[model samples]
Target: MTFGEKLQKLRKEAGLSQEEFADQMGVSRQAVSKWERDSGYPETEKIIRMGRIFHVTLDYLLNEGEGQSEDLAEGKNEEKGMYVSRETADGFLAFRQRKSLRTGLAWGLISGGLCLSIWWTEPGMILYLVLMIVSVVLLFSVKLADNPYRRIEKEPLVFDEQVKADLNAAFSERKKTAYLLRLTGIVLIAAGILICPLITTWVPLVDDIIFAAGLAAAGVGIFLCIYMTGILRAYRLLMRQETE
Candidate 1:
């Protein structure tokens, strides 16, 4: 394919119009049009910039013998599913991270409210109610409207071997950290629940304080577990999609 043809293909695949791409290249629309027509050639610097912009090698753009008719993003089709691209996979992971954080925070706030309500009675009850309401809002805020990869949730996905391998490698390290967090969270929850009974006898009339502190620890533990589990599951979900 000609440089013009390749340039046009890259720009379109990236969902950029002539004017938009021209702006990114710091050139006029007419200049971009001329380049796509093969009447004008960009300088070496611009060509290099183009390679970076399209996530392709210089050979793919400069050499005519390079992967002709086989574009970098060849739109790999699967038997009965959509081909999940690298861009899509990365975007999905980022989206899941944000979602998990919001979800974890919501659960944490609700759990923490239980301790708060016990600590101060009337005022605590009001704050607890406020927390509950805030938690609900946080949970509801995790919507798919802004997520570009929302379709991945419903569609069967296909992946290249390399992508799956990379994800697994990263997940190996991630899993260890996640497990550590999960363990620490479990310990905190257990300690919080045990604190009341263990300290009640020694600290007379301090039932409220003991229970409040215990519940607070439990809340933090719950948050850690929920957050870690969420991210852990999200990575697995991607791997499973590749497997199935």
Candidate 2:
């Protein structure tokens, strides 16, 4: 029999309707329907759990016509637990990466513009302003992209352990840089605060320029800290700590 036929047959022999089976499987009724209709594949984690529920081996579930009738009767049913599909996990990872990239690009453009503006005179400032506007538009466009797994927000996510570990390592390195960026930002802002009043009294024209540059530095620094914290939050979610 096809996997769907087998699934339906097993549910019937167990005296459970589709809705009851869905509850037992920790999935929505619609998700169960989709599975039994052969419209979708469950995440690998769910497939493993299903074998435990039905007293069948992974070979039986994945391969065709491999299990005995007594298998279901011999199985032990565990309490249902939350899960996210592999597709959802992948989509979320992409989303987080895109967000981080957008943030970095935006900050880079703004900082570069401000730094060059201080030395390049009026034309340099104008060019940087144009780049800043373009960056803003790109940021908005990234945010407007459709989310592939909106429903993942409602349930506990089940991501691969290796993927989470990789994310941890990558973000940990980023955290070091984020800390340094924030420190640099604070120093720039403090220097501006100290110099602005004194320079305004003695060199008013350059005071405004230095103060503007300091403000840009501080803003970029704050964003770096915020972005790093956001990455950490996504890492926690991937590790399923959000459920805890």
Candidate 3:
């Protein structure tokens, strides 16, 4: 079918008049009419917007046969939380990698600065040990944060009941993970604070170590909380899309 035919079909399916569709697309009615008549094409960005608005692929709007294959594949993968194409997966992966790298660097700086501060005051071996533990936890967060879209893609979308339940379960699990990490950090901090005075009397080195460990734990905990919160928000958006 021609692009015009596809445009009309989608517009009708959406139960939108030309004026209404134009309003939704933020374009003039004449522009929508032109598109429906195949007199002109939308700009690249508008094409993407139209595809999303119509629940169709760009290829389909462009009259490319590949869109049918993609649509079929997308339908199958909807239940599996996968994308229709490798390009989509790769694009998401690249975005996640960039975000993860930035997060890792930021955490590294904070953790490094804390360790350096402690070391400067005194040569405390325990400070290094505590930083090491914190580093490990941050590493885990980095790994998990890198692919925040994984759960969204893997969720089943067949029945509304099942889909809603799965989304809720995933969101709750994410929240639980964040809470546990934060609780662990708080406990470590309290323990360190209580032990600091005792360690100071025993040896200066012990005091510094305890202080460094506490700071590291707190820093990592804060980072995890922020990271998980962002993921939860993203999941909400995905759920919205699924429902829409």
Candidate 4:
């Protein structure tokens, strides 16, 4: 047995065609084919990546024989259905953080602009509208950070044990933060809704202004709740995959 043979076996066991495997590893099908044919060797980085993808160690990939091959074969028969990658988990974490920041900023800007627009004359309203447009543009920027891996949506490749533990810890902390954001948003929205009817009774002279302020708070709160929930759901899916 050889490294090429092991790679071929692992790829087959994973139920991926050469093309699909190459796509996952960010390589060409021809490159994978060449490796499997023993005509070319993968670079060190690729070798490491292959180790991760196949859930094997460097030694396992480097040393090969019938015994080791048979061991892997038996392992595969157990049919571990899916996997997750440390790289993918980290990437998802960063993406979610960036997106969360942008979402918060956008919501704050738009809501503030809306509140101001409510009180402004024509020219002032135009300025507030511009501010709101800027907020919308910020929201669009979320697409700028494109995900490079398939693991965020689907199951991920196998990660080293330590890497898996770290990812889980990080995700747990993030989940807590997400929950806090959700709670705060809910409280803000509840307060805003409750304050709406009270504005007239509490301060009749500035009823319209107070009402508009409440509306703005509620709008911001709604955006926060929606955005945070989306982030939480994505993390939850990954956690579920880890368990599976």
Best by lDDT: 1
Of 2 and 4, the candidate ranking higher by TM-score:
4
Residue 201's lDDT within candidate 1 is: 53
lDDT of 2 by residue, 118-205 (tens): 5666886788779899779867877887654444545454334564466567667766776676567566556544554345535655
lDDT per prediction?
Answer: 0.75, 0.61, 0.57, 0.71
Clashing pairs in model 2?
Answer: none
TM-score of 1: 0.63
Number of residue pairs clashing in candidate 3, backbone atoms closer than 3 angstroms, sequence gap of 3 or more or interchain:
3
- Which candidate leads in TM-score? 4
When 2 and 3 are scored with lDDT, the better candidate is 2
Model 1, 1-244: lDDT tens per residue?
7889889987897676887566556678899999999999999978865765565667778876545435454322213354455555776787788888888889988886788866566887788899999999988888533655544666566665776678889899899999999899889888988755477556545877888888888889889988999889878877776635
* Worst window of 10 by summed lDDT in candidate 2: 76-85
Segments in model 2 whose C-alpha atoms lie over 4 Å from true places:
4-91, 104-125, 149-151, 159-201, 240-244
| Candidate scoring better on lDDT of 1 and 3 | 1
CA shift of 132, model 1, Å: 1.7
User: Model 4, 160: alpha-carbon shift in Å?
Assistant: 3.4
Stronger candidate by TM-score (2 vs 3): 2
Ranking by lDDT: 1, 4, 2, 3
* Residue pairs in collision within model 3: 81-153, 81-154, 127-209
C-alpha displacement of 139 in model 2, angstroms?
Answer: 2.7
- RMSD for each of the candidates: 7.1, 8.2, 12.3, 5.4
